[model samples]
Target: MSRVTLAQWQMLAAVVEHGGFSRAAEAVHKSPSTLNHAVHKLEEQLGVAVLEPVGRQVRLTEAGELLLRRARQLLENADALEDVASRLAEGLEAEIVLAIDQIFPPDALARSLDAFSEAFPHVRVQLHETVLHGGVEMLEDGQVDLLVSGLSARGFLGEPLVTVRFIAVAHPEHALHRLDRELDLRDLEQHRQLVVRDSAQRQSLDSGWLKAEQRWTVSHLDTSIGMLERNLGFAWVPETRIRPALEAGRLKPLPLTAGGVREIPLQIIHRDQDRAGPATRAMAEQLRTSVAACAGTRNFENIE
Candidate 1:
């Protein structure tokens, strides 16, 4: 009861989602022993069992189910109050600075800013373009109130509005492009693969992605697309970015999801307890909806 905080609940939920001590540990980057101890400590305090072990797997108990819902509500309310308190202490007049990941498109932002400006034009909105791989770094620096960015490596939240599929891509004539099924990351070992060095690429491509004899790491997704169009090398990219190309028959996606290939996630982030004022709140709402519009999912699922 006394030690039951938002953190324990987070670990509890992670344990539930992942279904085992080891997997949940990996998901939250905590050790199994640590997670086990914390969960037991929480259960002891609450005087209700939280997990039921079933042949090396763990599922939530009845008490765990009840506590999960209550824990989530508490975490959310605590975050909201923190946001509110910070804004009041700051006089609600502090400018809101936001960092946009370089990979973030201007079109997505145009609509969001339109809604924000229409509602609160006087709240100074300072925008900065973050370089690739810097989304979380910028947030950690406190340089941005919110980050409208692509998938980050780790530590940042994995709030996905859109599931931007990652698939093997190539020009019309490349040997790999003719496949009907999407190519996975491992398939690149045999072909000339071009990989981008941006946030999207970093999120999708890793050591497990490929072991190709010839690989190129370009600075931009478009550049990789350009090389693909030239029949130079195959690469992985967001399907959304190449939807036009696929529609035009200029490129094709190899069918697959094996290897380390995965959809690039988009996230909106502010400090844990940092509250938004009228202007910031208005802008945050618009930003959230705008991301959902781009992503085609109304993900008001996790809004911390």
Candidate 2:
């Protein structure tokens, strides 16, 4: 079929919404006659009767319904394209959609956001907190502009940016605190390891010790923290995630084996189809810098 005319699509969409040519035409500032003629032209082009007059208002025929759906999509896409082009011409400024993993600290989030706002004051930024099963694929699909995902089993073709550490943590009053800073696997195994439920992102833990003990299994990272507080079980949580607690003497680090260590590397991921928009690229770089600042640069060598 021939491509839809912009005028006809506009007339069709307007009529569908307004239920009358006179109203639609007035809304679009076109003469009622002109709008009526445009719809007729569309019907002739499609070789189908498009509009059917109801008792007082008008409704779409089968072809009209289909055309209306397609017309709305086309007009929406056109508007998006036009806006992108306009933003590009003015400067590297457009609405940015960024996704961040929930593990990152909310306070640190402000610093990265501040940098973006200061750099691109004109551009709008929308931030979403994505946990596992989050919008990481959205970045790959171009539904999201950028994502702040940590290293995982699969590669996103992203650059090696930041490195994180997993530490053996327990409540201060727990039996493990009597030991030194250097943690051994035996001590970790002695206590039940409170693992977070449904969080596959941190599945790289070496739980040989826990399996030996056959201890209790709990859910929720925070709940695990609570369990640790109540001397329920020992947990190996991300160092970056529980750093404050460890420092405040609320939680104590029990020495664990270096071999069981795991590192989470943060990266910027974008789609092949997406031409990295300026706003997106800028924010992605800022995230890279922020993540690196929190954790050191990727130390893949240390990871076993």
TM-score of each: 0.53, 0.52
Off by over 4 Å in 2: 1-94, 105-108, 121-124, 131-135, 140-142, 152-155, 178-190, 197-232, 257-261, 272-274, 292-304
At residue 299, candidate 2 shows an lDDT of: 24
lDDT value, residue 44 of candidate 2: 79
Candidate 2, after superposition: displacement of residue 156 in Å? 3.9
TM accuracy, model 2 = 0.52
- Give the candidate number with the greatest TM-score: 1
lDDT of 2 by residue, 1-304 (tens): 6555876888888888998988887898999898888888888787888899997779999877886887788898888777667778955656878776655544356768888888776688887665443545556445567666673414456665555566677787877676655666676667676754432343333332366374655444566676776777777666656666766788877655574445655655664315676777777778766654644323222322
Superposed model 1: Cα runs more than 4 Å off: 1-95, 101-107, 122-132, 149-160, 178-187, 198-209, 256-261, 294-304
Native-structure RMSD, model 2: 11.5
lDDT of each structure? 0.68, 0.66
